[model samples]
Target: MPSTVTSHHRDIETDRHARTRITVTTTADATAVTVTGDLDLATSPRLRDRLDDELKLRPRALIIDLDAVGFCSSGGLSVLLEAVTNAHARGIPCAIIATQRAIIRPVKLLQLDRVLPLHSDRAEAETWLALVARLR
Candidate 1:
């Protein structure tokens, strides 16, 4: 089991002058980081920080649970991209659990689907892991 690093919600004021709320949680295995709430420019740095720290732990996989993400902007996309790039460089896999279009649309639009695997939910992510395990 991964340890919980921090869990809380905060308001991030964006350059567009929009106020967004972001909730973040990290588990002990330090492999999964669940983000709930809005993800925009102002709150994206927080995500960057969390991901940077998690990568240092060198987990086999990184799971970003975004099923509860309410909104996302380019900054949020950048953070996701950063994580994916880091994962690729380190030969680690990153999984995204997202059901909402708001979260999925951007990833698809950017064709990041070609890079990082996205799942509809946690169960699906686990299933993918199992498949990968069998394949290996």
Candidate 2:
């Protein structure tokens, strides 16, 4: 019999100068993390912390939504790379949602897009997660 995991949701907002918000929703198969506002030197730590907290939950997959992000700096990219590395090390799949050019362009330039599974929207990412869950 397949075990069922309960769903959980958390919304964490930071009061830092960059004003980033993180919302994490976890289900049996995956964890969806939505990030909004600027992602720069002043705010990357907040995101890093949130990712760490979610990673501790040990979800089968992690989907990071960056559609609402207004800006992303090198610091933010570093945080993202770290998250991907951490997830992979734990045998968890990780995907990214980044439609806007602001987020996509930089990622492509840095070749991080190749390292991360990039999706255009939440639904696409969720579909991938579903497939991964089914395979597992």
Candidate 3:
């Protein structure tokens, strides 16, 4: 199987705010993880778990789509940083698709743009993922 996976994203409104729902479906040959919702101190752990799980799959590349994220906090930044570092260490590339300012603002504030590659569209992410997969 090719290094490709299907990811799903959804949004659920809560009393305080809305949570994004992410579902990742991948075959034994690929890795996929989807995250939806506000990634803050309270929710960052969930993302960290997902990233850790994906790393075990040893995917050629990991695509993290943030189009459905409503808000991002420092804790979220920490998880993202860890995921990026882990991916780099394992010779796996990670791409973040962020088209919304809510998601991009925190990343920019944390200077993550300088550390991780960001894609404005899925096509570019797919292309980058393929390239990274070949590197590994």
Candidate 4:
């Protein structure tokens, strides 16, 4: 079955005092969250909660696109890792797109790219997600 996009940009999550933009697009089989701006301690929790909530719905797959993220801190990395872990625990496929240096530098420095299902291309990630979801 072809997945349907129930909602795109359900809401643009951003606090007046914050510096991040989180756009969550939910589909029947997948949820794609595109985040821009800095991802630090203050902003990562909101994202974590959002991902956790999405996982609770038990989507077939989850995609986090962080290509536009300008800066990512340890707290942000923790959030991403935790999200992927949680999704896996629930048997949900999760993909993370981190093509920019902001996310790539730290993940590689920590050697986490091996553990986190890192993908540089969204199309490739989506294709993989579909294949994995189908085989499940």
The best candidate in terms of TM-score: 4
TM-score of 4: 0.90
lDDT of 4 at 84: 90
Native-referenced Cα lDDT, model 2: 0.84
Q: Give the whole-model CA lDDT for all candidates, comma-separated.
A: 0.71, 0.84, 0.72, 0.86
For residues 42-100, could you state the per-residue lDDT of candidate 1 as single tens digits? 67887788788778878766788788788889888888888989976887667788888
Q: Which one wins by TM-score: 2 or 3?
A: 2
**Model 4, position 46: C-alpha lDDT score:** 88
Winner of 1 and 2 under lDDT: 2
- For every candidate, C-alpha RMSD to the true structure in Å: 4.7, 2.9, 3.9, 1.8
- TM-score of each prediction: 0.74, 0.87, 0.78, 0.90
The candidate, 3 or 4, that scores higher on lDDT is: 4
lDDT of 2 by residue, 1-136 (tens): 1228777888878555667788888777788888888888888888899898889989888888999999999998999999999998887888899987878998888888788788998778878767766776
lDDT of 3 by residue, 19-105 (tens): 555566554443556566777776777678878887887875677777777787878778878988999888877888888787788
Q: Sort by lDDT, best first: what order? A: 4, 2, 3, 1
Ranking by TM-score: 4, 2, 3, 1
Quote the RMSD, in angstroms, for model 1. 4.7
